[model samples]
Target: KIKEEINKRIKEKIKGILPGLLEEEIEKITSAKEEELKKGVERIIEDYQPLKEENKIITKLFRLLGDKTAYAAEKKPVEKTKIEIEIEWIELFNPYEVPCEVEGWQIKTSLGTRALGGIISSDSYRFIFNMVIRMPGKSIGKEILGDNGDTVILTNKRRNIVDKVSYRGYGLPWSAWEKNDPRSREFASILPGGSPGFRNWFWMPEVGEAKNKNDYSSFYVKDKPFANTGEIVFIHSGEWRTIRLEQGGEWQILDKITVADPPEKPVQGRININTASKQVLEALPGIDSALSQAIINYGNSKKRPFNEIGEILQILLLARLGSNGKDDDKDGYTDEEDEREAIFRGLSNLITTRSNCFTVISRGEVVKNDEIVAERKIKAVIDRGSSPIKIKYYRELSED
Candidate 1:
């Protein structure tokens, strides 16, 4: 019985792991002689039963094994992690065609870094393409701006931005403004700000007021009232500016500019099982392109949604693969289908009840060589359930 149980469990496991493989293939792999297979299965059950008795300990042991194995194997060679490709949004003057050049733009982040350089655009948003940078072998001592002005490196951390720096007096270096102008100096010294100007401008009104009139700046611009002040400022200007109310008064600067990132396109939604393309269906879990196509074909022929999962099993079974009665080859039922059908049948059988009749004998005396028996026994069987067996005159009768 133990062996039988193990064999059953092994069969179930094989069916689950390789649903596409035929039962014969599974049998070949397990290669257990009938009796040996049964013994092996029984042993597996015996081993598991004790563990099940101590469920908590067994579960923890398994989890620890998995974690430790993974940690220890971390040094082994692995496939490269997928890199997220950087997408560049270029500015176009025609709103359709790519731009020839973009000017007077600077990229900045919410962080304090400012003056991250951006490129020129005549058509769309101006952006650099295929930009790549490697990390330093050792940590850099302090934070410094990269050559493009769009990157800020601090120790091992680096940030990228999209915006062009606005030079004062055309050819003047960005560092020159740092000393002469407080706002320009602040913007250049800190991390890049959001589009138009440094992010600090939104918090510090004085900084917004200090930028050069012609230089572009970016700040957090909102139509709503400032958090500090319950009142809203509705000032409109052709150039970008950050407005904020300080303890002294409202501060607005003409040099402040706005910087905006390129808009992203919407993504396509999940594929419909009924009408999905082969590629779309193939992307689904546990489904291949061929299976997806087969599904479509089956659905088209039936002209309706499958009533139950079992129907698919039936279809696959009817389509079996090989010349042998048991061996289903290509274009026929897959091993997966058979396993699924078996599981479905098992579930269905569990709910069914048997009803039948039986008989029982009561009060019988045993005799040897025509001599009357000394002991008497009583037994009775009733038509209660499915099995029809003759009851011996020894056990108590059951009422039905």
Candidate 2:
């Protein structure tokens, strides 16, 4: 009877401890499985494509770590505005046959409106200065034009809108927007001191009318190599001779001098080789009239234009000879290839095969087992003239 009593007590004690141990073991297993599941989800979320609506559940669960980890995948870069130039004067052009009377008219800008009291002659230009248009109670000599962009509207005494123009200044010193084609109402940017009281430098008359280039003839040096002396050298004239600047910026041509040495610093602008005329090609150092013609002919022969600046070498070979591989230069060498190679190296940075403004599309893909798993595309507008070469526009294209 005594042994039976001891055995009953032992069984009760064993049962009590067994339930506790079982509960502890269950908790350990559940914790381990939950941790493994969480890690698997974390890996999936880490490699996920840029956040979409479908991944919100995973993104929220991942945020339990007290961080927005999903958004860190792709962060958009901050884009800055292009530098702008301020203007103190505004120009007005009259393209019609009859003159305009503006005694009781008003000119409207973003800042304020100024009363107009002058007559703009027919086929003429007029300039309004900043002091004349200063707003009332503002500081003396405030600029009328915005540094980045502005809209100028003109209205007559009857409050009828006469003309309005919207323009952006690209921070280029001494540049202004002027109508490029007098026949059309559209305007274009004119560089280096715009024509204030005369026709624009880039004015293109009607199709049959003779272009009056004499207005800008004083500023342009025809068929002359640049001397880095602040004078503008018009590149499209044939067989540019080396120009030496005399006193008062007068150009003295030296026929004996052929090649112009490269400037010490990289120039601000570049010419498109694909679109430049033969005369413009002659403007480069060591490129003569014969070479320029060869380039034009080579460009014409190719169905597709040059894709890169290096492709000019093929035309340079034709320039070595008269395109028939004969001794055209009469330098006693028929296929002397070194001369053309030197020219290519000299003109590389100054020339481009494309325009100043172009679009760039970039794509990226994740592939697995010969199949695309994920893909992304981005499009941007690249303006080469802008300083620091920032993207003017950007967008994420939907995957097709």
Candidate 3:
């Protein structure tokens, strides 16, 4: 019986070992199949990589070509949305003997309705600003006068009436019209009418039915007061058409329109004396043609050629005394003396002499200073003359 039990135990062990051996063989076969499948997938991907790269390159090339073609297509040039006009005027003031260049002056437009008048009289045309208008493109039509005596009209290639509206000159302090004025109200009712909009007229792409009628009474001016100074230009059909006085006066169209460029500003290190023409002299403060000529004459008479601009003060004093300093006691100065001194004092800080030298007085000391304050050295001098003189010596220093 014992021998039979041992044989039975050995048979049970053999059965368990056979099952484990079969499981190991199955696992080996599964692993080999998985490796073969991975290799096959990698081979497929490697074979198509060049074709994918080629496709990407072709797509980029086509995109670039399409961009170039679109860029070359023709298109109409866009019209300018706004127009610019430069105005020039000769302003005059009272005491006609004073000189035209010395008068208060400015440049303006004609379409805007405002009046900048001081004293209204036939003789005291206290200020007359002779104006000239400048435009960029071709002129279509220009009207010197309009139904409203002061209004002027200008047009572009399309011949659209630029100044179809009218403005009243409200004299003196209240020199501009009210927004509720019949003309202003009517203009505001129209498509485009009010302050700056009035200058643009009703000629905008967004404007539809309102473009037909020429009347602009439905439009209203802005309630704001007129600007003390500025320009008003009329833009229509993508072109600059007309200019009006937006501030300081009635809309007086300037007929002397020209195409020349504006003058260049004066250079530094140079002195522009009042001796130049009306245009040149106007640049100086309180200088008019008469006064400018006077200044020129005084400059010429000085044999020393103005070592410094302060010499002008002395010259003006001399000129006021009829070219003699003898009247020093008449209070003892002439009207010319007072006028010259006043003018020099007004411009003492701004004006420079051709010699590029200036004088400065600190208390009782005469100090000579140079152009470059950074390297300036202080020195003192004394003079026993009636007028205490202070001199500052300076030269144009190198900018290292």
Question: TM-score: which candidate is best?
Answer: 2
lDDT of 2: 0.48
Residues 1-400, candidate 1: write the lDDT tens digits: 3334333444444444335557886676445335544443343333232222323121111121111110011112321111111111111112222233223333332223323233334223322211111111221122223333332221111333222333223222332112111112233322221222111222222212213565433333554332211112224333543232221223222112211122132112323344555665544433444555776788789888654332443344222321225422122233322222222222221111122333555555578999975555456555432234433334654333
Score residue 62 of candidate 2 by CA lDDT: 20
- Each prediction's Cα RMSD? 38.9, 36.1, 36.9
* Residue 175 Cα positional deviation in candidate 1, in Å, after optimal superposition: 56
Considering every candidate listed, which one attains the maximal lDDT?
A: 2
Rank list by TM-score: 2, 3, 1
Q: List TM-score per model, in order.
A: 0.16, 0.28, 0.21
Cα error, candidate 1, residue 150 (Å): 35
lDDT of 3 by residue, 47-160 (tens): 223223323322111121111010111112312111111111112223223323311222224634223323323213221211111122322123232223243332323444
Off by over 4 Å in 1: 1-272, 307-310, 317-400
Clashes of each: 53, 0, 38
lDDT of model 3 at position 289? 59
Give the C-alpha lDDT of model 1.
0.31
Error of 2 at 204 (Å): 2.6
Better of 1 and 3 by TM-score: 3
